[model samples]
Target: MPSTQFSLNIRTQPSREPALPCHETSEQARELVRGTSLELYSDGALHGRTAMVAVEDPLRITVSGLEDIILSRTPGDDEHLIAGHLFSLGLIRTPADILGLAFPDNDPGHAVVRLRTTKPRRSLGPLPGGPRIDPEGIFRLRERFEQRQRLYRSTRATHAAALFKADGELLAYGEDVSRHCAFDKAVGLALENRLLAGVEIAMLTSRLASDLAAKAAMARIPVLCGFSAATSAGMELAERRGITLIGRIGRDSFTIYANGRRLDV
Candidate 1:
């Protein structure tokens, strides 16, 4: 796989101790480089009880106008973060739409993208209004989720995101400790390969919140499912954007938060 490189002049600050409820000693904040390494933790009894630690900076991606969103949890190429974000928002539809992404030689935070199509104007139709969700697609989405959670078994520390076609073909998958990173990576993969148009469903391992629902709505995905719960604000956004927000997914059931017609049986 080809890689894109960019550099950051990050300043490491002293780790401040977090406040504790009743405990006397707050765990000392550990200091380390922010983005260069993964912090691995142990899993069980005696050893797990110990503070097994490593140092690294939390990963973050800043869009030109959007505030800098932190991408901690899972780690990988940052470019994927941007690409995956675009895919979920429905901006890039086909392989030819996203030409390529380049981080200029000296600019670290800015990325210049070659679009497959002329950048369309931002005016979007009214929030996709309709029934809450179609039943069949919602059920199938719940089933596909089991296969996706296997990634969590490996890192226990990473969040996963997957993009699916309407019929449920898995198009792209990404994992990061940060839900934002996970989605970004997934979108990046689609844009890099021009596969967004083929995507109809997105499953994220994060809470279905306003920002997330907004992104999926912007990407034009019809439905989004999450392993975690959805906030009231997220439900509102999904309703307004015409995106179906499904959460509390299990092997047999799931909750449909908005735009049911898209999930119509």
Candidate 2:
């Protein structure tokens, strides 16, 4: 992936506040990828180093006491992951449909979502009208999205997803070992905060795959931008779902694969 040149004013200052406490202790350790230390030889010199990698673990999701599916994630934001997963899969229309989310006391890797309704899942339909975004606004949103990727900056092994308004205000951001998980986390955060009622845009550090495009469509986001290319299936889905898919985001340029009318050049 191309390096992001975007910088935020907050980046210059050290964060004085301690990291937020996590409810699950095991989750913290799982975020750190472990591997044997290795020695590097360069320019006739040898140096030993330990590197931090992104972690991936399987999470089993169950709905109403029934096994649904399993996902590999980076361990944190399990609740958001479940919420986003359900929404993207078209299992629930809104957050109110979710009665409660729980993790097993003995197994943090297992999550169950209790729903108020047992409706059959459906595919995402066409989205409502969203605010028109210009090329400059897309660039700014991507820059802000990249700036919020703290974990990726540290490990360089994580993917990020950010929710932004068409006008370029960032709503929420998520980073995880898997691109899908990252997108789900961001969507989950927005849903919890009731921030997805309005038409929004989703920016990702990963490629615009069909799955991610479908997630954005299901979430009712009208625009999806990525730092990389979009798959053919993704473009087709975006076109059918009324989503404007923008990919290959450069510093000041981007390619619109679908719904270009929403993007003012």
- Could you tell me how far off, in angstroms, the CA of residue 57 lies in candidate 1 after the best superposition? 4.0
Clashes of each: 26, 0
Q: Distance (Å) between predicted and true CA of 171, model 1?
A: 1.0
RMSD (Cα, Å) for all candidates, in order, is 13.1, 7.6
TM-score of each prediction: 0.62, 0.82
Q: What is the C-alpha lDDT of each candidate?
A: 0.59, 0.75
Model 1 misplacement above 4 A: 1-73, 86-123, 127-143, 148-151
Tens-place lDDT digits, model 2, residues 120-213: 5776568657677878877777777777887787678899998888777778888888999999988877876678765478889889989888
- Looking at model 1, which ten-residue stretch has the lowest summed lDDT? 18-27
